[model samples]
Target: MINQKSEVKVFPTNLMKQKETTTKLAIILPGAGYTSQGPLLHFSSGHYFKQEHDVLQVNYRFSEAELNPFDTDGFSANVLHTLEETLKETAYDQCFIVAKSIGTIALANLLKHPTFHNASAIWLTPLLHRDDVYQAMLQYENNSFCIIGDKDFCYREERFANLKSNPSLKTLLIPNGDHSLENKEDVLGSIDMLKNVIDGVIQFSN
Candidate 1:
């Protein structure tokens, strides 16, 4: 789907190019203000594409005035609307999700749909403060991973520590990194952070 402000980028695997949903798929969800074009977002999508999995990236917009990560209802509606429209024509037999920040909220809500019940996921900078996120995560039936920074104020490390016992859930904690997992003051350090993040993505998606 395409419009003035929103776009959905789909990279079909070689197999899917000839057919559809005949291969594994990776659905990417973006942060509130972060479009699917963001470095990390598309970077991960590329990884999935390289792995021979189809990719669907959602780029959407919501009114900034009414958007609040905590409230989530408006944000959720915006994301679902874009997703439903972008994916209404197809169904995937195997799908996984990669989401960041508010994207985690969107992914959590998406999990409610039967289509994604057992889909594995990768959560980046999830809003642990929101029950809908961590709570919905509990219902995830497949292996998953969550990557967050120590300096990310949106969530607490203590909340994530509680998930240590979940065998299906893997966690990566970045030092001095913020919500985007970047250390604004140390660009060099952020490279290492990015490496770790991408490594986790590769490991999880495979």
Candidate 2:
């Protein structure tokens, strides 16, 4: 976790010491309540680190009031602004973004910027209820992956169908899993599902 003021945590790989001209950056954008230390983001950050990519975890903080209105465009604008400001001092030749829930909203906006237009992305439990988020995913032409659970409130059969149809998009639909990708009725199943998601993220990143 990072300080609220800074809101960015950096994990640099040892390869950075080699002074390579080309650099790969992995950015993790977490949900409002879910910090980078959460299971999915934590493991994904480790994966990217082991792959020799420097990791940047954006730990955006929110008050209870802010959490309730997270679905608003104002929230998305705040996220985009925080992310842009954090990256102002960082540089990388290539970029990969992993975003969850509200973070996915930020990713959608970031995709519009020239700096991140070509970056690959992984969307976990995205807020498909928002038309802008859905439209952003639909129009993105870069390599991207999305994973969502059927039981998640944001999940809509029609919207998932539309996203699945995009050639550049790869998706995983978890049966009976909720917003956190957890299956209340089947603990082991949730674990297995999580592994599958992690595997997909690793392969897609490669």
Best by lDDT, which number?
A: 2
Cα displacement (Å) at residue 15, model 2: 15
For candidate 2, the 10 contiguous residues with the lowest summed lDDT are: 9-18
Query: Per-prediction RMSD in angstroms?
Result: 5.2, 4.8
- Indicate the worst ten consecutive residues by lDDT in candidate 1: 9-18
Top of the candidates by TM-score: 2
Model 2, residue 21: what's the lDDT?
34
58 Cα displacement, candidate 2 (Å) = 0.8
| Global fold similarity of model 1 (TM-score) | 0.83
lDDT of each: 0.75, 0.80
- Tens-digit lDDT string for candidate 2 (1-206): 12234333332212221144347888888887888888888899899887878777877677777565444545555556665666677678888999999889889988988888999989999999988889989989999999999999999899999997789999999888899888989989989888988998999987
List ranges where model 1 is wrong by over 4 Å.
1-21, 68-71
Model 1 Cα lDDT, one tens digit per residue, 42-139: 78888877776778777655456536334555555566676666667766677878898878987888877777777888888898988889876655
